[model samples]
Structures are given as C-alpha cells and as structure tokens.
Target chain A: MIAPVRVGQAVRLAEWAPGAPIELSEIPANSAKEFILPASETIGRYDRDGARFTMRETTPEGPRTVLLGVRPCEAAGLAIVDAVFNWDSRDEFYDARRAATTVVATACAQADADCFCTSVGGAPGATRGADVMLRLADGGRQFIVESLSARGEELLRSAHGVTEGEAAADPLADVPVRFSHERVTGWLAGQFDSPRWQEFSLACLGCAACAYLCPTCHCFDIQDESTRTAGVRYRNWDACGLGLFTQHTSGHNPRADQMARWRQRVMHKFSYYPEKFGMLACTGCGRCARMCPAGMAISDTCRAIDAEESSPG
Target chain B: MSIAEARDEAPGVRTFRLTFTDEPARARFFGQYRVGMFGLYGLPGEGESTFCVASPPTRTEYIECTFRRAGRVTTALQDRGVGESITFRGPYGNSFPVDAWRGRNVLFVAGGIALPPVRSVIWNILDRRPEFGDVTIVYGARAVADLVYKHELADWQQRGDVRLVTTVDPGGETADWKGQVGFVPAVLEQAAPSAGNCVAVVCGPPVMIKFTLPVLSKLGFAAGDIYTTLENRMKCGLGKCGRCNVGSAYVCKDGPVFTLEQLHRLPSGDM
Candidate 1:
C-alpha cells in the first residue's frame, strides 16, 4: 500500500512496508504540493561557449506514480492551486509534474477543530482533485474504492479488489460549516479599510508558516542563480505575509505592515481570485489555521468577518 | 533578437533598440502593440524583467527599452553586447487611450528613469500632432545626468507645437544647466498648464506622484483626467505570478495604466 510514513517530525508519502501498516487515520501535516509543484527546480540553464550563448529548457524527470491516502480537503486544494498555475500562461514545470501524478483521496474519518471544509464548498468525500477515492468498509477491515475520473477508471479496471455490485454507503467525516462563504466574500469586499484587520493581525509574527504549509497559496518569485561559467533561472515559493512581498526596489512598500499583508492573504483568496478566476483560492484544507503559531484560524477569521455590520460607503 | 543600437541615457541607465532575428517575430511585434504597453525582456538564464516597450507605437520597425541597472536581470542586460540574444515576451497589459484624447490638450509629466513609460505616449501623441491640441511637457530629474531621453527632450524643445519645461533638483544643476531648478511638483506648479479640456499623464517614483497628484488637483485637474502607471514588481506579466497587486487589481493585468479615480478606489495606504 502507498501511504504516508512518519519521517522524523513530519509525515511523508512513501511505500508502506509489509510489517508497517499504512497510516490513514490522521491527516498528514504536509500536503502533496511538492509532488506537483516542487519546492525548487531549475527551469532552464544557460551556457556561454566563448562569445556564443546557448540556453536549454530543463526536462522534468520523474516516473508516473499514484498518490494514495490524500485527504479530501487536501485533494480539493490542489485544484485551487491548479487554477493559478494554469491561468493564462501555463507553467510548464507544474504541468509536466501534474501530468505524471495521479491522486487517490481518502474520505476523512476523523477531524479536529481546524477542519472546516464544508464552509468553503468542500466536504470529507469531495472528489475535486482526486482521480480515485477510497472509503472504509462497514467492518473497517477493507476500503470501498470508487473511480472519480477517467484515469481512475483505468486504474480501477486492472485492480484485484473484490465486488462491484451495489454502491457503498455514505463514507464521509462530520465537519461543521463554520461560516458562509458568500457572506465572507461580501464582508471582505468592504473591509479594505476596516480597523479589524489591524486588530486581527496584531499577533501575527510574519513567520509565513501559514503560507508555506498551505496547499493553495501559490505566490512565487523567479530569480537567476549563476556559477562562474553557467547559470539557471528558477522559481521558488514567496509568501505575502512578509512585509517585503510588495516592496519596490526604490524602498517604497505597497503592503507595508503586517495587517496589510494579512489583508492581502484573505482578500486574494476570497475576493480577488474569485473575481478573476470564478473560484475561491481556498479549499478549506485548514493547514494554515493548524500550523499558525499565533492561534490565527481562517475559520474564526471568516466567522468574525461575517459577524461585522457593514457601514455606509 | 539582438541589440541593434544601445545608448547611455543617464547614470546607471541605458536604452537598447532590439531587432528580432526572424522576420516573423519582428512582424508580429510591430503588428499589434500600442502606446503605454510593456514587454518582458531578459536572457533565458537571467529570467524576464518587465518594463515599457519604450519606443512609440508609431515606430513599429524595432522596439526599444530603457532600464536602470539596479537588479540582477538589469545588470545582466547591461553586460550584453550588440550581437547577443535575449528573450522577449509581451506587448502585454492595456494601452493608454490616446485615440480618445484627440482634440484635447495633452500634458505629459515625468521624473527620473520613469520617463520610458510616458515617452511611449508622448511620442504617440507627437506622431499624430495635428489630431490633438496644445501639448505641454514638464519633466524633472535628480540631476542633469539623471535625465533620460535627452535627444528626444532636445527635439521636443525645438518643436513649434510642444512646450517643454525641463528641470533638475535644486542642487543637481551644472554650470551649463539651462532649465528650471526645483523639484518636479514645484516646477510643475510654476509652469502650470491649464487643466481645462486636457488629460494629464504622469509617471514617476512614488514620492513624486504622491506630491504631484495633489498639485494637479489644486490646479483643477479632475481625478478622472489624471493618469499614471504603477511600475510594481512583476514576474509573469500575465497576471498569474500574483506579485504585482495593490488591491483586488493585478497591475500586470488590470493596469500598469490607471486613472486617479481608479487609483482612489484601490485600497489606501497600500501604494
């Protein structure tokens, strides 16, 4: 079985050993973002032979593999990031990597306080980014598998799994909807100058742990790294929570304070992205809320925004 | 595809006239570009940098870009020779509505290296001079050497239809300096062009714009009649990189050009 194996402090996707059982009960701390959009990769390299310079695009190197036991929320978050990477100018590296990977999502059986996929048009059994979905059987000894995409049907055709008689019963976890997504988006539209942003973001340490761990946060910076003879241009993750995210070279920062940065994060997800792409930038994975050191919860943030009375413009 | 000509416009700033290696690339660029649109220029290993297509849309033979040697890509661009090749991706973003301003007076104000974006519109208007009314240009820089487009500035001064007022900061004038000696906003107020039936296009560093906008307001320039460009940090010029944003608007997509009224609608204290 392919499953997440505990590696030191973090859980990583790996092959399950014979003696070691697959861990699918708890959600892994890390999502499958690296598998699709890697942490770092050289997009292209340039070589200068005397006065003649030649450049070549780097071909992606990885075998096509299926990822098993991804949570439903994490699976949905992948689709959110997919929209950004494929918006207008498609990222070749991400497209290549995504083409080589297939996701098999598992319905969440347990959830903590941070789980709120229901509020953002997601559910425990949501099959948004998953090719195949797996649910536990009534006796808990086996998994009832279902194919969601054409690729999943191909994989299922060759599998040795038992019967395909009748459809299985509902196999979704219980997650409460904390706030209305439409209400949150409407609230965010008018909160550009709200003092609540400063109040809500005062404790934010600008750690950017929320952005780094989030599955749908796709802001990136491109730069060139050079040796004495050759150089390569690469793209890496950039966090907007930092003050320097929108700083101009002339020492003028547009998003100057932590509150402005925090506001960008929320607005980009609920308002800006929705206006542009016709979809929310979040999939309610709740990783940002779970990993935040400041006790900041996106669920709580949305709820608070929903509760605020709108003032005349 | 290659730099046909390069000129040092100011200290740390240079302008390069690029000609495509292939006939199709040259044809395509000239076929569909307008005033105030920008291009992403760089070498493959150096990554792309965004800047205006500096050359006017009227001169469609070759494209030119003026940039200051500040960042990594600009420095790499500075080292390139005439025969070297660089990648280009654009004529992206919306263009200025110069056609709509026909029969209206045009006021162009620029500062320092921010001249490139405005220079595109300036030349666009000048090419069709008879289509517009009185044209006034008020430009300033930190010093005499910091002024860009010097050749064009000299030509503007000689034109019968154009009124050009050049300036340098108080201490930036040389012995032979013949223009006004003050900041751009102060000089703009002194050489105040009438705001009636005119569209004022301004581009500069943030501080210059912050001060100049109020001066234009006091001079009776309507907020809808004032235009500026946001040269924010960008990566993918296609609005996907998610960096060049001030509010809900993506500068790479929704603008590089915006009216003061549109700017007012954006989130305050961000820009």
Candidate 2:
C-alpha cells in the first residue's frame, strides 16, 4: 500500500485499488497547495566575502508529485491562487512546482451543512484544476476516469493496470446553493462599513486557523535570516487575519480592530479577488467553518449578505 | 561604490546617496526610473525596504533614498557603508502626474520622512520653472532637528517664484526657530492659499493625512485635485507579495498615488 496522506475531516488517499472505494464525503484538511506553494520556501541566498557580496537564486528542484483524491472544490482552489502567482511578476518557484505536479480529483458523493460549492458557481463534480476527474463506476466497485488535460492523458497512457470502460453516471452530491456568489460580491462591495461585519465577527478569537486551512488563501510574507556572513531570503505564508498584517513602522495600524481585519478577510475573498482576477477566492469547501475555533461560519456570512439587496453593479 | 554620501535627516531617518559600481546596472536603473517612483532598496543578505527615489529624476547621475531606521530591512540598510553593494528592484509604482499640472499652480505638502516622495516632484518642477506657474511647498516635521532638506528649503525660499513654508509641531519648535509653530494642518490652514486653478500633492503619516484632508477641502480644493501616496508594509514591489492591499486596491499596483476622490470610493477606510 502507498503511504496515505489524510486531510480535511480525516479524508484519506491511499494507493489505487481497483475494487477499493474512494473517500468522497469528507473534504481533505490539507490541500494540494502544499504541492505547489509550500508552507515555506527559500527564494534566494546571499553571502558576503570580506567586502564583497555574492547572491545566488534558489531554483526549484524536487521530485514530480502526483496527488490523488483531490475533491473538485479543493482542486478549483488551486486555480484561484494561480492567477495571483502568475499575474504581474511571475513567481518561478510556483511555476516550477505547478509544472511538476499532476492532479487527479474525485467527484463528491455527499456534502455536509458547511458545503456550498454550488453557491460559488462550483459543482460537486467540477473539473476546473484537475488533470483527470474520477467518478464512481459500477456501484463504487470501479472508477470511471476521464482525462481533462494533456498531463492527465499522459498519466493514463502510462498506467499499467487500467482498462477502458464506459463512462459512468457521476454520483455528485446534492450541494444546495445557499447564496449567489455574485450577489454576495455585489453586497460586499457596498457593505464596507456595515455593522454586519462586527456582528458576524464578534465571536472571532483572532485565531487564523480559517486562513491557514483554507485551500485558496495565498497571502505571503518575505524575510531574510542570516549568520555572520551568509543569509537566505524566505517567503512564508501570511494571513490577513493577523493584527500585524498592515501595521506601519510609525506605530499606526490601518486595520485597527478585529472588525476591520475581519472585514478585509471577507472583502478580499468575496469582493477584491473577484474584481482583480475575475474569480472568487473561495472554493466553498467549508473547511473554514468546520475548523473555526470561534464557530464563525462563512456560509452564514454569505447568506446574511445574500438576504440584503445588493448594490447595483 | 556604495554610500557616496549619507546625512541624518532626522532623529531616526538618514539620507543615503548611492552609486552602482556596475555600469550596465546603473544604466538600466536610470532608464527605468521616473519622478515620484520608489525602489525596493536592500542589502543582499538583509532583504529589501521600500522607499521613494529621493533624488530628482532630472538628475540621473546617481539615486538617493531617505529612510527611517525601522524594521529589519531598514535597520540593515542603516548599517551599510560607502562601498557596500545594495540590491535595488525598482522605480516601481506610478509617477507623479507632473506634466498634467503644467502651467498650473502646484502645491506640495509633506511631513517628516514623507518628504522624500514629494521631494522628487519638488525638484522635478523646480528644474523646469517656466513649465509651471506658482510653486508653493508647505513642509513640517516633529521638531526643528527633524526637518529635512534644510538647504533645499532655504534655496526655494530665496527663489523668485517659489513660496516655501516650514513648520515644527507643538512643543517641537526651538526658541530660535522662526518657522510656523504648530501641526502641519493648523499651519496650512493659517497659510491657506487659493485652491483655484491648482493641484495639491500631500504625503505624510496617516494622522497627518486624516487631519489635513479636511483642511484641503475647507481650502476649496476638489477631491480630485488632491493627490497623495500611501506606504504600506510591502515586500514585493509587484502585487504578488500581497500585503500592501487596502480593500480591493493593491497599493503596489493600483496605487502608491491616489486622488482623494479615488480613495473615497474604496470599500473601507482601513487605508
């Protein structure tokens, strides 16, 4: 058996077994984001010899990784972050990692109360960022696999034990559309100073677990750590939930309170990310709601906004 | 060679004049920079600090940057010597829309280390005096010793066309100080000029901006006529590093320069 990597509500992915079942109910705790944008990576290294400084760029060199059992919601999250990493200045490290990975995602069989993929214009079987999409065939005894990308075709071609079979009906979960993402986005654009932000964020303990566990939260920080003569520049994951995110050196914080910070967290994902990248920054996986320490639910926030008349776009 | 010259502009701020030992690097640097733009100034092992290009774009011989010794990158920059090589990544963000203000009265308001950004435009306008109309500069610092560009201020004061007003904050003025003695907003209100047919560019800390915006409004300056730059803690001068956003606006990409009206439209006042 291959080493299994378990994530999101104890969802596990083991080595392929022809008759074995795939975990389709639980959303994985960790995302395929680790395969592309790792938690920590060194971008450059610098050393000083006497009075001279010499620096070397750190290039990506790692084994080609293949991720299996990624849900459609989880897979789609990668595409949102991709727009940012490749937007203005192309991040070679992310590019290199992206080129080296192959993703195989599974359609969901069931969704919980927290799941709202349909609300965000995603379906349980959406094939957005996956190389290949798999659906349960022959009553969970076999997977009806279809190639979605050139990489998926290549992987399927090189496989040893697979046999061609008719496409099975996708057993997608019934994920109700709780709110219209566009409507929520429109409402968020005008609700910057709304009291709902305070009301929604009242129970927030300032723990950043939501952003940490989110599949699409891609903010980062760059720093340098050095010895007497040598140093390395590292880019690490950062979240907007922290108080220090926008604090200036002059001891002034633009985001002065939890209300503003929490407002940023929601606005960035719902309003700003869509405006800039033309895609919502959320994947509707509901991991944030499931894992929130304060019981803060993103679905509740979306519904609250959806209940109001949105600003005319 | 590095650090050709350095001067203490204030208690914690220092101005560094630097040169590139590499010919092509220096050539590339001059070609890319514009007035009111900033650079990601750094040491190789120390990381990068964001600050405006203090030297005027007209003077292309070398670049100057003024920064307060704060945070890791600024602290490392403060320790560098004359011959040390520094890593520079830009001339990033938008430039001052100086050409648009041609033949119009131009007012520059700056405070403390914020003068570096405005200083570039100041010299740019001053270099071509006939291209603009009346040029007025109102600057203030926390204290008398905190004032920067003392020589340049004196030079502007002596000029035939330029009007310069310098001030020190309350309790900050020395007994011998002759400039206005109050906050910049109060001093500006007292020295209010006609807001008609003019453009105002203001740069300072947030509190200074908060108080000064209303004063500019009271002076009859339209929201669109006032421009200001924002400085957020930034890593990538490009929008990729991602911390410099306020609302949907990425300060690094969408702005470092924004009009008051443009800022008014943002979803939040966090900026």
lDDT of 1 by residue, B161-245 (tens): 9999999999999999999999999999999899999999999987899899999999999999999988988887877667887
Measured by lDDT, the strongest candidate is 1
**How large is the interface RMSD of candidate 2?**
1.7
For residues A172-286, could you state the per-residue lDDT of candidate 1 as single tens digits?
6789988888988988777788889988788789988888888788787887777656888777878899877787766778888898888888898888889877888887878
For residues A1-313, what per-residue lDDT tens digits would candidate 2 score against the true structure? 2112444347544444555554555666666676678778888898876557777867775557777888888789988889998887788888888887788888888789899999998998899999988887777778888899999999999987688657567567999889988888888877787878889788877787888788898888887888768888888888888888778877888888888888888888898899899999998999899999888988898898888754444
lDDT, candidate 1, at A286: 84
Each predicted complex: what DockQ?
0.57, 0.69
| Predicted model with the maximum DockQ | 2
- Best-matching candidate per TM-score: 2
**What lDDT does model 1 reach?**
0.84
- Residue A268 in candidate 2, Cα distance off native in Å: 0.9
